[model samples]
Structures are given as C-alpha cells and as structure tokens.
Target: MWFKNLQIFQLKDTENFSSTDLVTKLPDHPLRECGSQDEFTFGWLPLIRNSEQWSISSDLCMLVRAGKEEKVLPTAVVREELEAKVAEIELVEGRKVGRKEKADLKEELVFSLRPKAFAKRSDIWAYIDLKAKLLVLNSTNAGMTEQLFKLLQTTLGSFPMVPLQATVSPSSIMTDWLVKNDVPASLETGDEVEIQDASEDRAKIRFKSLEPLSEDVTRHLEQGMSVKNLALRWTDKMSFVLNDDLTLKKVKFDDTLKDNAFNDSQGGALSDMDANFALMSLTVRDFFESYKVWFEIQDED
Candidate 1:
C-alpha cells in the first residue's frame, strides 16, 4: 500500500491530456487473462482497494499492470530432446543429423511445450500530480517504468514524460559533503559508504554500517575517488542509501510518520483509511517536493 521507491517523471503540457481524456481512454485497455499468443498486456485500474476506476481530483492515482506470458522450454531440456531425436535420425538414416535438422527438432520441441508455459504479471501504481504536472512511478527499475511509459504513448497517442534528473549527480553533492567533513543540517551520516575510482577498471571501497570514515574514506577522497553510495538519515523521518543516480535504496520510514494516520483514537476501532491515505499522500507529496529542486534546475535547461 506504500511506495518503496519512485522513478519520477514530469508531465510536459496540460493541453495534451486532461482528467476526462484519461477516464475515456483508460477503459480501452482493461486487464484480461493471457491468451496463448499473448506475450504481454497493459492496462490501468483503481489506485485504492475495492475500486474499479480512477476518480477526478487534483492528484490522479491509478493502478496499472502488465502481464507477460512466455513459453520458455529450458535449453537443457530442449538439448536433451534434440540429442535423442538426432541420434534416432542418425540410427534410422545411417548418418549424422545436420545442423539444420537439429534446429528443426528444437523448434518442434518448443511447439510441443508452448501450452505448458506459465504467465507472470507485474503491477505498478502511479500517481499523477495534475496540478503540479508530474508523474510518479512506484518502481525503481528503468525498464519497468519505461514499459508503462511506452504503453501510455501507445494508448493515448502521446506521452510527454521526461525523467527527473539533476544537472549534477548526487555523487558530486556527496563528494562535497565528504570533502567538507561536515554534517549538513537536519541530516546525519550513517556508517556505510561506497567510494569508487573514476576509471575503466572502477576500483571500489566499501565501508560497513558500523564503520566510520575516519581515515580510509578520506584517503579515497584524497585520491579523487567519487561517492557511489552513502547512507544518510533525513531528520528521523527515514534512513536511506542514496545512490549516485539520486535513487533512494533501502528506504525505511519512521513509525512516527505512520502512527499519525493509523490511529486508534476511538477504542481501537477507527476507520482511519482516509486519514492514512491523506498522511501517506502528503508524505509522498512532500517527498517529491523535497527532491523537486534537484530535478527542476536540470529540467529548465
């Protein structure tokens, strides 16, 4: 129910699509059971539990899923079957099977096994800040987010999503933080850090959670190595390993943030879903706002 990570994108123009437009186009790509020939399917649905569609609002949230069906007969299995068939052909014809004949046998094996393969589905929830003109994907994987992006382009005739990036990688900022040997306000450095050399070989240095920079970390910086991963805590709200790409990994929110929404003020039987939703939404909304400056500057140019 909570987003673990975000692959952020900003909407380009409001004139191209509207809430009504999304409502009209979304139903055209509803989820369906995978067919024998269907390799993949994409569609959008409700963001909340026990709902069927998106509601018009300042913030537009939707659940989208992509289903893929693949008939993957293992190479080892196919190889064994092919070997047996090749031997059988050789024994019957009094000669070895040619490469072309072996390829044909493999194709036939796949045909026989196609009906037994299983389908796998992956679901991603997305939030569109209609007022702010932003799209937030709840996936850290670029491939998964791009798949959904392409699907939007296919269904809507246009998709204007530029990934949120900074002109300077977060690594540079982290390097500066390390160089100054100073902790920034409202932020505390954790014991974990990764410093890598800027060369083809890319030599690396990793520090454990219980270890401090002390001397080894400083020596790497002196040698012009850059920060690849740094563990940091943001004002007791969450602690995360911030990557050079500005992606947060191993993010954990504090209970104080959760307790406000999941309250039991009325004898432990409170319908606090809306409260939780509001708090989570606000928390996520603030998360974007906190990082927006980093991207906005780069986007402007």
Candidate 2:
C-alpha cells in the first residue's frame, strides 16, 4: 500500500473520465498468474488476493495490482542435464548423437523438467490518484511499469499515460540548489549527493558523510559534473534520496506516517491491516502532492 518508489504518470484521459468511472471497467481485467499451461501472465488484479474485485476508497484512490509470473527453468541446469543425457545416448548408440537427435533429447528434457520448474512472480502495488491526476506505481523498473500501462489501456479502452517529464531538468535544479546552499524551505538537505562526469564514460561518484556539501563537491560542480542524486527531507513526513533517473531509495517514513498508516496494533490484526492500507494510500497521495509542489516551485524558479 505504501509506495516505496513513485513512477508518476499524467492521466491524459482525465478530461473524459473520472476516477469513479474505473470501478465498472477495471474488474473485468483481473490478473491471471502464469500457469503450467501458459508461458506467462501479466495484468491487473484486485490488490487483495481473491477476496475483493476492486479496492476503491472514498479518497478517490483506486487500487489495482500488477502481477507478472513466469515459469523459471534455469538454462544452465537444463543444459547440464541435457548434456549428461546426450553423452549416455551417444555411448549407447556407439556414435556421437547427431544434431537432430541432440535437439530432440533437449526438447524432451525441457518438457520433463518444466512441470517441476519454479514459478517466479513479481507483484507491484499500484494506485491511480484521481485527485492528483496521476497514476503511481511502486515499481522502479520501466518494463514492469509499461506492463501496467498496457494493462490500464486494455482495461479502460484507452489510457494515455506518459512518464513524467519536467520543463526544467531536475539534475540542473538540484545542482544549483546545492551550489547556492539554498535547499527549499519545506525540504531539509540530507548528507549526500551523487555526481557523474559528463564525459563519454559517464563516471559516477557518490558522496556520503558530506553533511555541508562543500569542497570537492563544489569543485566538481564547477568542473562540469552532473548531479545524479540528492538527499532531502519532506518537512516531517519522510526522508529519501532521489536518483539520477528520479527514483527513490532508502525511504524513511517519520512517525506521522507510522502512526497514521500503521496505527498501534490494538484491533484484530486483519482490521489493523485494512487500516494500514487505507492510511498508506492516503499518505502516498499527500506526499506526491507535496513533492510535486516542491519540484514545481523549483522548476518555476
């Protein structure tokens, strides 16, 4: 429920449809995990396992889960077994196993082992923030996010979601902010920043324990280095470092989040879990808005 990383998308369809419109359309496209009969499965499912069809709250947030599953048979392991079988067949046949025979044997081995192959699953929690006009996925990987985008499009008829782009480069704004030592009022500068060389190799440097962000960092900034990461606090709610690609890492939610989102475990565990999910959904929305405001202010400046 708590999105560890935010990959934002502008809801291009917002003008024609509202969040309330999704409840009807989304349920039909529930995720189907990959099965023995199928090679792969990827789609949207209710966040809860089998219980709810769609998880929507009064806050205008819609919960849709992205599930991807693939049958995993390690190629190396398969090849080792195949090789041993090929050798035994060659010895019994009193000749080298020909290309066609080896191929057939490999196919047989794969079919024999596939049912025992482990299934790998990737489930990412995602939400559509109707109020913010954004769809945020907890996944940082572009491929998985694109899968969600496709799922949304398939479910809703058309979902024109594009990766967030800013008028001003975040790298430039972050570097300037560091240079001036003028971290924004709502943001408290943390003790790290990552810089990468602008050369062809794109050498990267990560500086930790640089509390004041001075000396070598200032010199590197002067030397045409680009800021690839910046650490900062969002007032009192949380602290995190922003990567060059604008992904979040090492997020630490302050007490406000823990208290509200997780509430003290007084009620039955299931009720508490439900409360946590709701609180987390709302918290994620508020934080996104706050971060957007902060970045937009910088972009404007």
Candidate 3:
C-alpha cells in the first residue's frame, strides 16, 4: 500500500539538471500531507535529444497520503522558474546546445496503488473473479502469473478466517524448456540414447566474444581482471550512474573511429582510443544508470 495516492510530476524541459535545486525547494512543499511514514521521492533528468535545439525532461514522483489534497503553490511555481533558469545557464555555457523546449507536458495528479493492493489482499475469491479480466488485459507470462498467485497465497494465508479460491498455474519455464529442448519422437535419423539419472554436478562456463564487450560491466570485467571484486568495484565507480540494460539497448559501433583505427599507421595514436573510450564511457555511464536499480537488486538477491 506504500506509494498509494502518490503525486508524480514530469518536468518536460529540465531533464539534464542536477537535483540540488529541487532538493532545496522540497522543504517549501506541503510535507505534512505526505504523512510521517517512511517514503520514497526521487527525480530523473533525461537528455532526450541533442542538437542546436535540445529537448530535456525530468520525472518527479512522490509518495504521499491518500486523502491529502495536492498543493500547487508559489513554491512549485518558483521551482519551475528555477529549472528554466538553470536550463538557460546551461545553454549559455555551451553545456547544452540550444534553448530547451517543454513538450508533451502531462500531469497525472491522482494515482493509487490499487493494482499492488489487490495482489496483496486476503480475498482470493475476489482475486479469482478478476483472473479472466487479467488474462484478457494483462501481458504477464504463465511464470509471472504463478509467481503472483504464490505471492497472493502467502499474503492471504495469514488470514485463516478468509477462504481462498485462486488456482495457481504451472510455471511457463517448465513448458518452455520442454518445447525448446525436447527431441521429437518422430525423428527417423537420430540414434536411440539411453536415459540417465540427473546429477548435481555444475559446469563452469566462461563467455568470450571476438568483438569488444560493450557493456559497463563488460568494460569493468575486462579492466578489473577479478570476478570476485568486479561487482564491488563497478558499484563503487559506476553504481547510481550507469544501467546495463540501457547500455546494451542499442549496440552502435563508431565506424568512423574504426576506420581511423586502421588508417592511423603511425603506431602511437593512443589519443583517438583515449577519446573514444572517454566518450563511450560517459554516454554509457549516464544513460544506463537510469535503470541500474534492477541490476543492483539482482546482485543483492
């Protein structure tokens, strides 16, 4: 039920700015309405495009009370003005190419955690009533569906007075593995192989690519030389700033740089490599961190 009735704001033109200004302005907002409970409030500034005229945006989501009336006051107005002022400064400094424009301004003022709440209730019979609806509307795989059912069971199990009726489906992975690897019995050329009992032996696997590994973790792995310290070192240097998913979202090799790599016959052209590394490092570092929390969670688990 956390983050229920949260207020989220999208600043359509101030995505590349630091959070210092916003953090300073937070105390002016109606914090009393957010309640005394522990909550999360964060912002993300994304540089959507770069050119003579650049486009930037920010996402600001806050967790607050359900019944609270959201406030739009002089402070909010000042915050907006401050963001515009910062953008102007960036443009003047050549940090940003041109004037920033606000586009696709959308405000979803009233939101609730209804979906998560429903999945956490003790009313499985009521949940079953929604299964058909979910199958029609949700895009979840069977594995995810089973996971949800299990989560619901664990949630409702504590409430013994309530009877649960939801049925858990078999995991999709069980079916997927069978379909992918199961040999057809109708195959004529294959030799008959004897079935063997499964063993607990685990195989050590190493991945090697002829092409350069283009991921932050890959770069760290290639540079760190220690698998045991890779996660910790990468986290220290790149955590909260790089995202692996987004880094590999698009694999673009600089052909120009590649050509230059071969063209420079003068054996000591390390500057080009240095510059390329720096640019690639910065781009991957910034865009990837936006979704790095998922990687952090995986590591922790």
Candidates' TM-scores?
0.78, 0.80, 0.16
- Model 3 collision count: 4
The CA lDDT at 225 in model 3 is 27
**Model 2 spans > 4 angstroms off:** 18-21, 79-113, 262-301
lDDT of 2 at 256: 78
Tens digits of per-residue lDDT, candidate 1, 1-301, equal 3456655667787566766676677767655656665545555544443465343343354334343234455678878888888888899989977888788888887777666666665677666665556676667876667777876887688877776667667777787778777656756788899999999999988988544356778777878998898887777677778788777777767789778656632322223433444455556566666665533434322
Count of clashes, each model: 0, 1, 4
lDDT at 51, model 2: 62
lDDT of 3 by residue, 1-301 (tens): 1000111111221233333443333234311322222122111111111211111111221111101112223445544755665577577876743333322111211121211111111110111111111111021233433433343234333211121111321112112212243212221111111111123542222323221122422343333221211010122122111111111111333455345444543443333433443333333333233322322212111
lDDT of each: 0.66, 0.73, 0.24
Model 2 clash pairs are 31-44
Candidate 2 global TM-score: 0.80
Model 1 TM-score on a 0 to 1 scale? 0.78
List the candidate numbers ranked by lDDT, top first.
2, 1, 3
Which stretches of model 3 miss by more than 4 angstroms? 1-199, 203-268, 297-301
Give residue 205's lDDT in candidate 2 (0 to 100).
84
Please write out the lDDT profile of model 2 over residues 49-88, one tens digit for every residue. 6566466553766766778887788999989998999888
Q: In candidate 3, list every pair of residues with a backbone clash.
A: 242-288, 242-289, 243-288, 243-289
